[model samples]
Target: MGLFITFEGPEGSGKSTQARLLYERLQRLGYPVILTREPGGTRIGELIRRILVDLRHTEMAPTTETLLFSAARAQLVSELVRPYLKTGGIVLCDRYADSTFAYQGYGLGRDLEELQSITTVATGGLMPDLTFYLDLDVEMGLQRKRSARDRLPEPASAAAAFTPHPEWNRLDARDLAYHQRVATGFAELMRRDPDRWRCFVANQPVDLLAEQIFTQVEPMLARIVRLENPR
Candidate 1:
């Protein structure tokens, strides 16, 4: 099987940046790799992402939010992720089913078992080969998000072609307590499957963090090569 790596963490944790860095690194090494993000990847998934993140959707129920995320994921896996993996290419995803568990199940107080059932159907039992959890203080992460939102250009500006500050969405409008639970949820997930997770302090310097992540990923790539060429 091809390498499937996921980045998970609280808001403003730099998961997306790290995923991109890793994707570039793999490409430089002549490995086939693709970088993608959750809630949006394929055409259908992008539509779902719009609904899921729109700030006006504050009234969206927990179950509805969960299902929407799952729907997007189902489309992403079938259309992109699964097929690419079949060709032995690496996939670097910003988030996956784990975000659903962390945000909906733990943060929103939804039933974990029900979420698990839904995720199983959405992903068709696909799981990440390695998951990097970029650990950060919840309050600090939220503050970073606020600062980022403030830096975005106005909608009418030429630089702002699409939505203005898309990352600052309805989920970011949630309370600090809810985000704290989500962080706790991530911790619980890592504890449950320690072998598949690599936790890192999100406050570290960017280059240092990227090097650390690359060091961990290099061994996994070697393992994949050995598996494909087992004499």
Candidate 2:
């Protein structure tokens, strides 16, 4: 069977960059690999991505936003992920269900059970074999991005007519209390899924962080090679 690895973190945690590095390393080692991301990775998913990420759609509801994310993920899995995994390709995903749980369930204050149910249905029981959770302070995470870029609607000007922000993005503009809740929620997630998910401090330099990740990944790679070369 193929390996499905996902990188998860708040915006600016460097998950995307690390995911690319891992993909490149695996490719150089002669492993067949597919690199993709959620809210995208398929034609239908790409269309949904625009709806989900556009800063102009500030009126989008929480439930509606969650459903759209689920929809895009369903299409991505059915159209691209499964096919590649069947051929023994290492699938490196930039964000997955964890983002929904952190951003929607915890950050947006949605029902956690409901979010999990919808995600399970969307993914068709497809879970990552391994996940790396890049941990960073919320302020640092935001600093890494310089500005809101992860599907957050731009904050309205003070003089404009009142408009409610979508729940997912509302978290982005929240006070320290809400962001603290998000951080706690992610820590709890890591605690609950320790076997499948590994939490790494993202405060280190990029090269050092990459080395730490490779230390974990190298063993898995060796095991895979052994399996393939079994006498």
Candidate 3:
């Protein structure tokens, strides 16, 4: 199977940019790379994403949110991710099941054990080979999101009020304490799986951050080259 790399962080952490940079870099280096995201990878996933992020759905229960995300995840894993991995294509995902753990399990005070069980079923036990956590100050991330939304010219989506810009959603508009909890949750996750995750301060220059990521992924490229041209 191909390498699965996931980018995890709070909103405005610049993880999406970094993931895109890595995907382009890998492609330039001639690796077959696939860039995708959770809650909206496949068609079904997109529908789920709409429901999850649409600000109008403020009544969405936490349990309902979790299941919706899982439903989208199941479709992505089965429909796209699995086959692409079997073909040895590198998959760079913006968010995966870990978001559930951070947002639902940790931030919303859901049972971590239960969240893991559901996510495992949704993903069929597929795990990322490397995960990059772009640690950002919760406030800074929020500010960045606000700036981004301000800069966008054609802003308001009739589908949703909260900017899920591949960005923040209804979840992000909550108070600082809620977001802080999510950030803390991310920290805890990194602590639990130190080996699988690379921590980076996302406040740095994009080029610098991307370079650091390349250095890490460069070693993995060896595996890709070998698999592609096995002698």
Give the root-mean-square deviation of each candidate in angstroms.
Answer: 3.7, 5.8, 2.9
How many angstroms is residue 122 displaced in model 2 relative to the true structure, after the best TM-score fit? Answer: 0.2
lDDT of each: 0.89, 0.79, 0.87
Winner by TM-score between candidate 2 and candidate 1: 1
Worst 10 residues of 1 by lDDT: 222-231
Runs off by more than 4 Å, candidate 1: 157-164, 223-231
lDDT of 3 at 31: 84
TM-score of each: 0.93, 0.84, 0.92
Report the number of clashing residue pairs per model.
0, 0, 1
Q: Compared with the true structure, what per-residue lDDT tens digits does model 1 show for residues 1-231?
A: 799999999999999889999988788777878899998999999999988887667789999999999999999999999998998889999999999999999999999999999999999999999999999999988898888878975578644443424658888889999999999999999999999999999999999999999999988786443233322
> How much does candidate 3 score in TM-score?
0.92
**Highest lDDT among the candidates is held by which one?**
1
Query: What lDDT tens digits, residue by residue, belong to model 3 across residues 1-231?
Result: 688999999988998899999988787767888899877889889988878887677899989999999999999999988898898788899999888999998899999999999999999998899999999999999999988877766655755345455555687788899899999999999999999999998989999999999898888876664335422
Please list all clashing residue pairs in model 2, or write none if there are none: none
